[model samples]
Target: MVVTVPRVSGQVRDALAAAALAVCAAVAAAVWPEVRPLDAPGLLLLAGVHAPLAVLRRWPGRALASLVVLALPYHLLQYQHHALVPAEVIALFGYAVLGRRVRVVLSVVALLLLTCVVGMAMRAGGGSVREQIAVIEGVVAIAIAVQVWRSHRARVAAITERAERAERTREQEARRRVAEERLRIARDLHDLLAHSITLIGVQAGAAAHLVRGDRPVDRGELGEALASIAATCRDARTELRGTLQVLRGADGGPPEVLPGIAGIAGLAEAARAAGLTVVLDDEGAGTPPPEVGVAAYRIVQEALTNVVKHAAATTVEVGLARDGDRLAVRVADDGRGPAGGSPRGFGLLGMIERARSVGGTLDAGPRAGGGFTVTALLPVADVGSVTPR
Candidate 1:
């Protein structure tokens, strides 16, 4: 998608070339007849050599080839070389620009042999050897000059291609870093809000029900629940600010304390407050890396959040285990399954992304027992031991 117009310098060069070709054609037409006998074949050869110059830029190889094919017979049949004969040298240069060097070299050698043979024939029929030698020298000098020109152009083109590739590689890296940063910020936001919001909703509902009922509220329990809700809100707000500050690049690094594998208990408590009976069992080996920990915590948190919103289940089970080089997590709920259920939305999508980011795999679907199950196998401290998916 980018269109570039010709530079003024290039346009000027093309104009000058067109003008020069026109002058050559005019001079050849008017002068060649005066020098040699006026002939129809000579005029046609003149036209063929000059006319192809117009299309040299568009198809330099083809135009040069045509000129060479036309020139052999034109020079051979003609009784003597005319002023217009040097036009073939210009075609040779054009061929060097767009064609192969070996081919050009071969062509020059062939032309050399042909000219000497013609000179021999001319000598046998009354011609001069010295003039033929002069022609050979001119042809050799021109071929050498054209080869040098082609070498320079080839070098310049190679340098230009290398620079373009470097620029493209830099651009792709910048885009990739930007995308990864955005994903980190998003995962932070989801972890902070999903669990806290669910807990706050449950606490608020309980407080409302207690006040609305005929029973006198236990002021201490009511106060404690409200305090918990306030504390959760405060933490959520601070976490959000940290996440945003990181996104803006004002923060030094990730929030010093990201919720990790250890924080799954809070997710369970939040589910309990939301009226889901949650049983959590964590059995793992060596500690996971920070990135893997964050991913694991977020995956569990999101799974529980989905249960609170859609499952309406009475019992939920959460498990974490480390086997060999992998960390495995499973969340199963005994509720109405995904069939005839509301779309799970971006929550599951985010969990899947989290899993993959840490070189993990996720599988979430309805269980055969009329519930839903979300299972993930993630690379943890032993990430280097496993090949990337």
Candidate 2:
């Protein structure tokens, strides 16, 4: 069986050391021939010097002062001197390692003065002045070495903290970018599927109505409805393929051409196929920046999708005009505004996010006259280039 010995705490070890030093000083005072015999006052002074070692780390300034105070009398009264030097060294080392600069300087000066007084006393008792000078040098060396070690440890700790802070900042930025990319992809998928599926549903319904009617089915009308469904499916497939390419991180071909302001006519045509009269008015001057154009196209697309899906009205007017440095887009439909009062849905939220992402604003609400209107003001000039996501 292995016997495990518990580790001693720093305070406990320091106490043991202090007690051992006290015992040693007492023994030396009693038996050493060159020093005076141990007495009550001398024993008290020895205790004062060694006892502070037990708490040297916790209170370095106090410990060093205690040692210096008691050691003076011990040396002046000519008690045994050698045993107390170890305690003095420990005290000085503790203060240098932990004490503030002003206190350390003051303590060092006090200790040097005490050392000079001791050397003078020893000289009168026939001790060599050279030995005292060497003792003073040793004390100075210990204080300087401890201070250098402390400074080096402090510098290392500061550098480690800075590196850790930089790592955390990088991680936070990466997470933010990932979140933005996910939101952009979701908006794209929603707009693509919603428009295509809504159109296909409307066309399929028309074809079914013609077949189930009591009158003989109109073959031309039936064919037109089927053709619209087929065309919508084809467009949806192309857009899905492009989106998939982006998801797979492929750079094999020229990028998919995104629909922009020019694509509004196509949207209007699709809505017209769904049995709505669409009036498109384009009053814009020159072409907008690609980012602005894409935003405009998506907002119009989403607005029309909402109209076809929910509006019972038969007419929608889409207007695009340049107002100074901004492009104004407005979509209005004679629809049963929004069901149950407020205009709230994921489609509207996505449109708002897209507008704000390019430093623009969108307002959507029911017109007081009887329909819903979505109006967006997009910057047309000097809108900084954006990477397609």
Candidate 3:
């Protein structure tokens, strides 16, 4: 259905003008013979009220007061019947449309009361009890109009506030639903992909051992492939668990630390099993806090995994050094070159994100002689201690 737009201010102006015009015509008709014939001054005063009534909303009290004073002499000279007129009605409407403060209304009403008293005392010809009653009735009409206008304004304001509150509530609910969906996806990735990749490393290591010296596959190549699988699994687990914890709720336990400097030996062992010559060197052996240590371990692990996946290096080297408050890990491969010698995608991005998440930094690129190198620095103290250096 179509709806028409309303112009409230324009409508108010038109209404007030129409009312004033009617009153002017009435006064002219009732008092024309008694005064002078219908002419310029009479018609002009009658039309003047209508023009100002359009601006009554902008200046209600002023308009109302001006009209009352103007009406006085017109009534006195024309027809002093102590009767209600069109101008009086328009003045009343002006008071209602003005939206002035209650204090202002009270003050204006007090003036009207004084005017009523004086008008009664002066009492124009043949103006008596009946005339006084008519004047009182006009004042009553003005007061009622003011009250009705105030009530309409208050109702409109209340509705606007309610609508705004409802909109905010809906937006919050949408965010909550989106968060829940993310957690569900995280749980699926953890259970299905992370666990599957881990098993691939175990199987690959075994396959390399079984094929030792007789097959087309080099035992060392198989071992490096397995090592890469294991590292990928660990990284996936860390990312997946972090996501799922949000679904479980904010009250979940501290983050699961994937292994740190201490886990370097395990990494070396896995790489060896896969047949790649691997070495691990630690400059500082102090145990670090779960977060920093985990970040450090993951950095080295991912770098080593990348070396196995992309580097043609037969030997991988990992070095860890702690300087003052910081711990740094460096992983390098002395291989033919990166498998395709082209760096791409999530491997490097994940390493950078892991380092940044724990307030650390990472650098990865090609080495001078050949192969690829990755260097990472983690703030051990900043992330808190897992164990003392």
- Once fitted onto the true fold, the runs of candidate 2 whose alpha carbons sit more than 4 angstroms away are 1-10, 22-43, 57-65, 71-85, 92-133, 385-389
CA-only RMSD, every prediction: 7.0, 3.9, 8.7
Q: Taking the tens digit of each residue's C-alpha lDDT, what string does model 1 give over 1-389?
A: 99999667654565467557646754655564432443677757766656666666667777766766665655555434444446657766766776655455546555754675564556444343445445556766777777777778788999999999999999998998888877766766776777688778878888888778898988986886787788778867776776667566675655536667887887787677667899999865347887787778888988887787777789999999887778888999999866565345678888888888778999998888778999998877666554322
1-389 per-residue lDDT for model 3 (tens digits): 99999767775767666666757565655574332344556555555545556656677777766666665544444433233355566567556655466446645654665566566556543545455546556665666665666678778989998998999999997887787565445434533353335445555656656577565777676666656666657656675676557456656578653455787787676556544788888856477667777667666666666665556568988888886777777888887655466567556666676677677788887788887888888876857433221
Off by over 4 Å in 3: 1-21, 24-44, 51-258, 283-285, 336-342, 384-389
lDDT of 3 at 156: 91
Model 1, residue 16: C-alpha shift (Å): 14
Rank all candidate structures by their TM-score, best first, as comma-separated numbers.
2, 1, 3
Q: Judged by lDDT, which candidate is best?
A: 2
lDDT (CA) per prediction = 0.71, 0.81, 0.63
Worst 10 residues of 2 by lDDT: 124-133
Better of 2 and 3 by TM-score: 2
TM-score of 1: 0.74
Pick by TM-score: which candidate is best? 2
TM-score of 2: 0.83
Ranking by lDDT: 2, 1, 3
lDDT of 2: 0.81
